[model samples]
Target: MPDRLAPLTEALLAAARKAGAEAADAMAIDGRSVSVDVRGGALEQADRSEGTEIGLRVLIGRRQACVSASDISARTMAEMAERAVAMAREAPEDATIGLAEPADLARAWDLALLDLADPAPEPGAAELQDDARRAEAAALAVSGISQCQAASASYSRQRVFIAATNGFAGGYSRTSRSTSAVAIAGEGLAMERDWAAESRTYQSDLPSAEEIGRLAGERAAERLGARKPKTGAYPVVFDERIASGLVGHLLAAINGSAIVRGSSWLRDAMGAQVLPRGLSIYENPHRPRISSSRPFDAEGLPTAPRDIVRDGTLKSWTLDLGTARKLGLKSTGSAARGASSPPAPSISNIALTQGDHSRAQLIEAMGTGLVVTSMIGAAINPTTGDYSRGASGFWVENGRISHPVNECTLAGNLRDMLMRITPANDARGHLSHVVPSLLVEGLTLAGA
Candidate 1:
């Protein structure tokens, strides 16, 4: 309950200065997690972990090096700083390697407004196991489910603090609770499996285990008679569950790191139309109770809402300090990092504009196509935007789902795909990526 992470970060920064580094930053994270899994109506696995980790990044001249350790002792902090400084001395000079200026650092954030950490006490392993068991029982209760493969419940809490020689210092804590279930339908080679899961910042906000499990069972039963559809060019609807992947590809294309390397398909598309007219991609990092919501980035810079794509045009690239400097642009405050790694450009919460039509309405209008509920592998060409992936879901005919389909491929260029999408107003607001189901036209399907 005491402030454990802040003192560790302060000590780490002090050690870095003592080790003769020109400048440095430190991060300390303390985390605890408990998870329980149930199978065959019995507890199959239970695990718990608690630990504290400290990381130091030291800069000498234009070079920087990072080191991390789980040992929280004063001696280890000093040793980590010394080792980081030594590594920095031998590293290649990069003008972009530096900490944020004091003026640029975030100050006076409202952690309470974010409501990241749940106020309730942590659930015990017995409670988690009970949740898992209930989920499994609910899945087995479904009519067509052959078996409940696995059901799980978990809770995690993490406290993170960041400090730098440039006068940046801030810390926050977050908690997550989740429940999931996997159900199998049919028998032998005809068996199909599917899962349902939900996570929330607060345990009270999480959906009931029975609801998650029943959904999983229903999904598996829906895939019982899957067969490959005929090969041809067809319209495809990426279901709301999997639609985020399509938008994720766009996020990657506009990433500053990819742009700086000139390896992204959209590297030269800053002002070009990337989405259909009237569509936009927006990011917000301060949305209360969302897992990715943060007042400040890993680099201690303030994060704010921004439109990555505005009215169908590429408006901004996701950037951290290093990547922004390399591209002669200002940082987007999108930096994210782990204890053992340097900060890199990353998105927090993003949403694609929802359309007026519902998912059912879109399917009814499609006439004949595939409704892709799940995907397996990818063969994306980052630079050229060529995209292909294994897909499985329902085959639609006469504007109605005819049957389940599997073992098929969907191929198209990402750039072309984005330009031809029709969004459905079915995005779940609770998700970090609030992308609605997207319908794409003229994609080549490889199947029977």
Candidate 2:
């Protein structure tokens, strides 16, 4: 920790070029965390947090601002670089802001093949309350659960750092580990809750605690006695533990700041044909132990591997570097930010592109419909790619499934529901999207 983010981004770019700013950028963070919670047999909460933060942005030509702190003295980084160079001298010019062009930054790569930090030794807090009391006693020893309510365990570490005045600077460090459980089932008002979690970056690829309390007591005893189905159009499926939220609504309708604010709906779909002609999605920021692997970006650029849907067209647009200079297009390094704003267009480690049936053969090739599996809220319109939400699970019929239903809703339109997806072949691959278990077909729902 004797780096202090390259001397707090070299004293926040010498206090934004001594406050008259012309260009600037800096970011810093150093974090730490630990959590543990459990219920019914001890410790219901425990937390620990550590800190260090700093941010600055400045600019002035093509105006810019942004400021942040956790007081990294030197008079709070010289009053956060003179209040971000007097708020970028009254901000508001924006010819797509600036920074990032020393031949598009990111000079040199490979952070040990991005295994992203996890050289062990961190756990504690009584080893996260004994991994949340052995994941709430393996979800109350299964058999129609009835309680395990909240069990958790966590750990974290950060360390970021960016820096720029166009010359760029870098930094990295990461670590994580988690475990969760929720369970619950029949009783008053006929209960029924469910949950299960896992996260890793080694903890030897976390997973136990009785495999997250027996998968949260077999998913709350498979939603004990639910019911609702019956209300118009059909075919749904979805569930590969929430099919990467339908490719996260086509990656927020191909964000490039929502296609330069025309409010995306695939913003007139670039190369058109969106999904289902052969699927595809790609992305990949250097995988290795994943967790949205990253090498540069956040304005230091260099994050390779692309294809935002190929074979099915609609490729690219998740830019960054001021939305690729406001759409004159290019910087698909897909920036990202924190420590308080600046740098947008996110997305990292995608995958999708796997299908050879098998989600019970797409539920016997959808001989009936709806399979969902938890979802709620979200209406979504984002410029008319419509879509609704709510949902629950189990209902198939002619091809298996059958019981458990609940609430309902569903609706459709995400460009004709991802042009009638299909996907399946399990997906997971250390997530950060990696979609699968899709199916689709018609939609509408509503219910009972």
Candidate 3:
């Protein structure tokens, strides 16, 4: 715990109690971020910012109020508490809004095992600019590449402390570093764009800027002279990079808040077979080097691994304390929040089980279909599971990639599409959301 943040949180909690609140929790987050962008072989934009933010959440019987401020002075803390309590008195009552009980609070945990932050000194602006320049240069080196769109590098560090009137208190620090490059091919109406980026808790884990840039340039060049495929029902294979979106839908549907409100497509899907047999989606928050790993959540709850989808069946809903209480369930230790808002249920470090076939083998298995490499917009029905998206990718014919295709709409029902998924073995290992390329059979494709 940072010296300044912990004391600030304790003071806010004290102020809230003195202001006649029955219960309260306080949070303080101090963070610093730096970013540099390069374009056309010149420095384009640079930014560096740092600040401390504090929030107080007070409960007056069933009513709750949350107040936040960037100022951490003593006077601001008193005013925040006073205002929070006053607002709570006027707000509508909610039976489920309260802090976790003392028995359920995480008392002690080893954050070192999570390995969230890098101990290295912060990278200077010059170093970040150099990285951006290198990425841009590498992207422009690729054959058939028209030009590099933008290249950038960024770093951030944050320290968080949470304390409550109840006996819960904990803090941790995390750091992130990233590099990205976007490249374009062709010109005017025929142009296409693609990008590559990587982020890691430790800078050492990030792939080389040159490698990231080269991959972006190649992806863009591959889509040059894209033509639309014929309109028909065909299998669609989502590339590994974007395949996680499919799983993300399931995650959203199973969120405790959505389920409690009866607004999720998967509300009645518990214990139902949601995925192909032999596949499971696991949530392991303790994985090292990944950005989502955390020993304790924002609400001071110990996080542990669980099988969200077990043996292809929908097993659990992601839940925080409040949502879990509303759903008549226990917290899954997935609470996440910022200084400006209340806690919410969220997932961390997800890994879908991989299959034996490689991406190429899956493409071959697809036979005649679409390999959707990128998607633009989404139109999804949360209650009905209807999903449609504008997509662009390569067309497959006779078990081989024929040419790039664009101006297509891939439409399918989420529940039906995921039921027949064929996974490939090409999931990026270092990503927080680890899902393989998925081939869904019998989807409607509208093109041209």
- Model 1's alpha-carbon lDDT is 0.94
Worst 10 residues of 3 by lDDT: 291-300
lDDT of each: 0.94, 0.86, 0.92
Give the alpha carbon lDDT tens digit for every residue of 318-416 in model 3: 999999888888999999988878899999999999999999999998899999999999999999899999999999999999999999999989999
What TM-score against the true fold does each predicted structure earn?
0.99, 0.38, 0.99
Off by over 4 Å in 1: none
Cα displacement (Å) at residue 272, model 3 = 0.9
Ranked by lDDT, the better of candidates 1 and 2 is 1
- The list of candidate 3 runs beyond 4 A from truth reads none
lDDT by residue for model 2 over 427-447, one digit each (tens)?
888887888789889898988
Cα RMSD, each candidate: 0.8, 16.4, 0.8
The clash numbers for all candidates, in the given order, read 0, 0, 0
Q: Candidate 1, 442: how far from true, in Å?
A: 0.8
